[model samples]
Target chain A: MNISIKRKDQGDHRFLVAVSGEIDVFTAPELQKGLLPLTEIRGGTLILDLNETRYMDSTALGVIVAALKSASRHQCSFSVTGMTPRIQRLFEITGLMELLKRVQTSRGVAND
Target chain B: METQEDESQLSEYRTLLAHYISQKDQKLPTEESEHLRRQLHACGILPEDLLGLHIEALKGAGIFSESAMMRSLNFLMKMMSGYSKAYREHQELKDWQKQLDTELDIASALQKTLLDGKVPACSFADIGAISEPAKRMSGDYYRIVNDGKRLVVTIADIVGKGIPAAMCMSMIKYAMDSLPENSQGAPSYILSLLNRVVERNVDTNMFITMFYGVYDPETGIFSNSSAGHEPGFYYSAREDRFMDLEARGLSLGLAREAEYKEYARRIYSGDMIFLLTDGVTEIRKDHDFIEREQIVALIRRWMHLPAAEIVKQVMRALKKMQDFSLQDDFTFIAIKF
Candidate 1:
């Protein structure tokens, strides 16, 4: 249940978040707190690094999906990196990998 | 034993009680009662200390003078005795529970073997399935109905255990049995009917994640739907790739007004439809769990075998991967068309 989240502002509204530790129901709220606001980075990229994250449940997946949706609405680009095989497979199983793959990879698009 | 501070507080309480009795005709303010509660707490009187006070009053011995008899022994002794009795009853209940669990396990096995009959035969597709419980009972349930031209397979990952979960599965099976035969075509329609049964009967905490797929051998189309279950896989032997069986819906019994969407895929010759529960993919490796891709890789590795043989081979490898000790119920069904 020990999750560590660190956020760095890359200037001009761009952000990089590095998350490590277990992400279950207990720690998902903490992750949501760290990821949601940065999704509003207009015309910027929000890169989420989950390489050191050990475990995650469906709840954490939901949080990430919500963050992706928020980013899309704000015209911010979103992408995930540093997923271990175990974590990557979780995304695949829940059908979120398909969604993640479709997430707008370009730098900016105007929100309608 | 009473602390020195508690002994002093007791004298103070006694003096106050004597004063109250002497002025019995006068009404004390409500604040005085609150003050007494605080004073008792300040004197380290535990919640169970009242038992000692009550015992003292019943004896009318006024043995506070002896002081030695006025400590927490009364509370501890009574609590210990009560706890001892409760522990004995708990052990007895566990024994009865063990007995009930065994009987239920037998009943469930018999239900699978004797009652529902065998998995119906499909002329064009070879079907293979295996459901193994981590405990004496399995909460995971699967039902396959094949009527030559059409095959409807439903797999559910129930969120409960033992008698309640088994009984729920039985009820669901009965409901499915009673539905009209034509209802088999629309996976969404069948799921809605099952959803009503689950919403009304199953406990609020117990929800079910299920995938219902109806395959037509004549048309080679497999129409499917999901109820918050894991996305299944469709393997194309010619393409050498797996397409995500992505259908989204709320978990059964989550809400009475839930809606499920349907998806259709063309099943070509040598293509396989794979549906499974979390138990299989969540199988552990030391501290971490195996992912769904590993299962996909396993299927691809043994792609040349018949559907049934591939199932057995994948299970054998998975069993060894986890060293024969499963942490949850492992249930999966594969059909090669």
Candidate 2:
């Protein structure tokens, strides 16, 4: 589990949480702990960066959904960027891709 | 008389062998053939019969007479040489086969030891972890340990497949064993320590993606660190949503003093936690890679079930999609908080 939580100093208060690796039953909790705290933070756009991610199972997909809900309660926006082809297909198949803004990289995001 | 009969059989067997040799363009020695002819002429049978007997023993030698043949030293020498060669070859083959089998046994045992089963602590109620190696030895390894305060569980995958990967897995196990027990604070620190241990020993070409965590039973809080392994999942029944817990960390052994961040979260009583290796993600269906939804559907379908049932259901889905034998090792560990 690799997670970096960055709060913007003076911008849109964007929270970029870059994650890579397989997210499944054993590892889901790690991401949950890392991201759940971000959800509690007052207001910031939560960006999940997953470019280096190689594989994701249902347990992992569930964590992202849970993180989204956690952030939503705080009125903080949540989205996934750097969707690998495998993960992108997963997001699309799970119907979450439509719900989140999928970007190739954090820099690739056209919207601030 | 018996010596005469033996000589006749010997000559006959020799003739057959000579014939076979001739067919294959090998010429018979004149003295040898002449001796065989003499043995047959002494008896009523043709020289061919004598030669055939010789071939049966496959040890044709000089002819034996009535008196001297009884003590036929020449015949004994021929028989000894022929029998010795054949027996030696057979013994050699058996020995070689035994040696090969021993090597395979050691490899198999190593594999089994690497994937040792966890007696799933009775406290968890339902917990299961399994790994299916595609070959003789699997590159996948998983462990569940009670950290007194929490259950520290992990599953790791070495990048390359087969024995090499399996060896790397062994290194991971040993490194994990060496880590300090139940240390509080960040799970990432433990992983960082393990990463240094793994890096110091493993080759630069090999890297491992691992999910290592300590889960507190009382707090339902789980802290974990990933090193280029896989994503994990958290299922929330109240919200009817499955969240993807994504953690980004540098792969272990990639660099010296590589820094890995730790992630922590609390799980409710109804929530479930799932972790797996890339083998699950790389599962194939109809000559195509299985998309994440098919996997989620498996979890969604089994959400109401127990932890073991959920793990089994997902495993079945992967098995069905595989159609053929899975090319990579498949490992899944599930724990319901």
Per-prediction DockQ scores?
Answer: 0.07, 0.02
Off by over 4 Å in 1: A1-112, B1-98, B114-117, B182-185
Tens digits of per-residue lDDT for model 1 on B1-337?
Answer: 5577555655544444433333434333336534654666555565467445434333533445433243323322432344455568989999999998888778867656623525667788888888776665666788888776688888887655455556666777777778986564488887877888887886544567789998887788889889878788888878978987888876666556666788988888888888888778778777667777888899888868877788788888888898998766778788888
Angstrom error of the Cα, residue B189, model 2: value is 0.4
Report model 2's TM-score to 2 decimal places.
Answer: 0.55
Q: Which residue ranges in model 2 land beyond 4 Å of their true spot?
A: A1-112, B1-98, B122-125
> What tens-digit string does per-residue lDDT give for candidate 1 at A26-49?
687799899988887677788999
> If you assessed candidate 2 against the hidden native complex, which CAPRI class would it receive?
incorrect
TM-score of each: 0.57, 0.55
